[model samples]
Target: MNFSAPTGNGGTALLRRLVWLRFVAVGLLMPGLTIWTSPVRANPHGGSVVHGDIHIGAGTGGHLQIHQGSANAIINWDSFSIAAGELTQFLQPGTSSAVLNRVTGGDPSAIHGALQANGNVFVINPNGILVGPGGTIDVHGLVLSTLDVSDGEFLAGGDQVFKGASDQGVTNLGRINAIGGDVFLIGKTVTNSGAITATGRVGLAAGEEVLLTAAENASGERIFVRATGSGVSGTGITNDG
Candidate 1:
């Protein structure tokens, strides 16, 4: 399944605000001027990295980009925050895993590939979570983001297993209940195809006002009891088979 930002002038403003709020949410003050440079790498064990900074490393099978702001500060970064001269990693020799834990930072941080967060975490992207072959991301706290299976065919072949391995091996688990925001999907063109299982209420909202709770398979499924002050009274979409 995929989720996309509604196109038009209205979406443009929302995207801009989201981008700006993201920067402030993490306390990143970029120079008024854009810097076309790579971020400094940090060696947590070597103290080569600074607190509240992002780190990039090379890998054989893939690449790992870690952003762990200060221990006291939050770690927030937008997936759209693009840069040049950035190191692009390819497949590593062995099945490698990348983990992005809050360790001690902010509310939401953009993590690519296999990742793990221990503290309160938020993923702010139309399709925030990306799962690859041998790629498994685990979260101990709230995972306010969308989960995606990238290149599923190639990652797990046509079957649920890849190279005799279970495709479900690359799973994204949200240990804590998700808070604010909605899960988003990504694709060239968004389509409603994935299944979302929420333990909490699911419905819609209009500026803190919940208006409807379409069918279960309904795209843009929202949980807005907080806004409406009333709960939905219907059997949400479900699979009978």
Candidate 2:
């Protein structure tokens, strides 16, 4: 059954099959190919917050719900915190070219965003994920992420968990609490210094070094902490919350 360029009763079917295969093959190898759950876009106006692989939005100290439509959320503030009763997710799956799946914030812990989610708050940045020194994540649901996972609750068994491993790294120096979920952080290298209060569990999976510290949670839970590897500075899971 030579179907490369068949010319028989099954030629049309063969051609269709070949075309489908070619489409898939090209989708995997093409340079400018895009695959996403929705059409993700960047902000028409630019955001200013930045640090390494992290970039934040203009939070503005208002209750704004970011739908992951055109750009990553860059939270900013003047004096108050931002409140959002929605889950911030990526517009689509990540590609190295346009990994539009990251959430960053202002420095000095000035920007505080309160998030409420039914499932998981996802940040699937292939470049890298970073929570700055002045950033804050306050959520009441699972934070499903591929790299940096903190500043919120991480509920387990949430829908469409993005466990994709990033080559860069995952670093956090803020605060996180999983009131009813698990905050799972997976990457090549992971660093945690702020605070993580997980009602379910807190996980850190890294390839090279994993830096962390223990702290007391809001509920008076004293958890031990430590770390391994060279680049990391904090002690192994020592509780300091």
**Which prediction has the highest TM-score against the true structure?**
2
Candidate 2 regions exceeding 4 Å error are 1-62, 66-118, 143-165, 208-241
Return the TM-score for candidate 2, rounded to 2 decimals.
0.38
Every candidate's CA RMSD? 17.8, 20.0
How do all models score by TM-score?
Answer: 0.28, 0.38
lDDT winner: 2
Q: Tell me the whole-model lDDT of each prediction, alpha carbons only.
A: 0.23, 0.33
TM-score result, candidate 1? 0.28
Instruction: Quickly count the clashes in candidate 2.
Output: 35
Q: For residue 41, give model 1's deviation from the true position in Å.
A: 20
lDDT of 1 by residue, 199-231 (tens): 333211111111112223344332221211232
